[model samples]
Target: MRSISVKIVIKTFLLVLVFGIFSKIYGQTDLAVKQKSNFWKQVQFGGGFGLNIGTGFTDVTLAPNAIYNLNQYLALGAGLQGSIVSQKDYYSSAIYGVNTIVLINPVEEVQLSIELEQVRVNNTFRNPTTGIVKDNFWNTGLFVGGGYRMENVTMGMRYNLLFNKDKNVYADAMMPFIRVYF
Candidate 1:
């Protein structure tokens, strides 16, 4: 089960990396063509990463997003995310999701955002007496929060309003994010 979890994580990471590289190349070409225009100038690339390590637990995440500016105050975007969590001699889990986001800037350096996401998660548990158990499910999440926006970077925090306490993979807690745009 542990080997399976690791294989899933590796495959997901590779797939994400491949897609990201392709997008970057395509975006560069698009930018060149729109160099003299202002419409393409409004598009931005950004994402967030997380890592945690402890005595017997570890969590890692990677999320990448692209945004299109609709106006001075509003922007829309889409993102893809993958995460893995492991606990020594306990459980290992893999999660992946897709999200659509809307961001509003009411004031300079301040941003408000809302996101809807659909996530799929797989968990493998190792038990002392029961041997092993595996579970897989899909869930929906609605997130609303605010953040600090800068010229080239943004930092934000959000809470999932629709988080399910019983079946969801993510905890019903605040999540922090940082993104860099080009």
Candidate 2:
């Protein structure tokens, strides 16, 4: 009962946001040119990185991306993703991937996104009695989400449309993120 109502509220909130943003976008009355005249002026580059090292575990991530703003409302971009993670005497993995993204900013403070990603995962697990086991596979995901935006940064949550419990690296299909692009 409560959970169902929460979901409905969330959906309604998103609809309201989209409607407000669209109205603001089309309501512009300024005579100013809406797009940049120089191609180079529309390009931006940025990425995300993470490093975590503790007692017996280590995880490092690097993802670099570039986007070309088609105009005030649209952007198309691509990025590379890489990660090295290890747990002592347990497992170690190398992940590499590429992704393409489309971002739409109907209003300066709200952005919607769709991204397609393919990652190759190589993992090795150690067992005292079984020697070692190696697992390698490719995982692809299509993510659709939105975020609150401020300048070149956005904070949001995205859900993977093709998540499998046994075949996924993440524990859940939903992931929270803070994205920054210059």
Q: Candidates' TM-scores?
A: 0.73, 0.78
The collision pairs in model 1 are none
Candidate 2: residue 67 lDDT (0-100): 95
Instruction: Report the C-alpha lDDT of model 1 over 1-182, residue by residue, as the tens digit.
Output: 99999999999999999999999999998987777477668889888888999999999999999999998799999999999999999999999999999989998799898999998999999999999999999988888989898876779899989876898866655788666767
Question: Which runs of model 2 end up more than 4 angstroms from their true locations?
Answer: 1-37
Per-residue error (Å), model 2, residue 48: 0.7
The candidate scoring highest on TM-score is: 2
lDDT of 1 at 62: 91
Worst 10 residues of 1 by lDDT: 170-179
lDDT of each: 0.88, 0.91
Q: Backbone clash tally for model 2?
A: 0
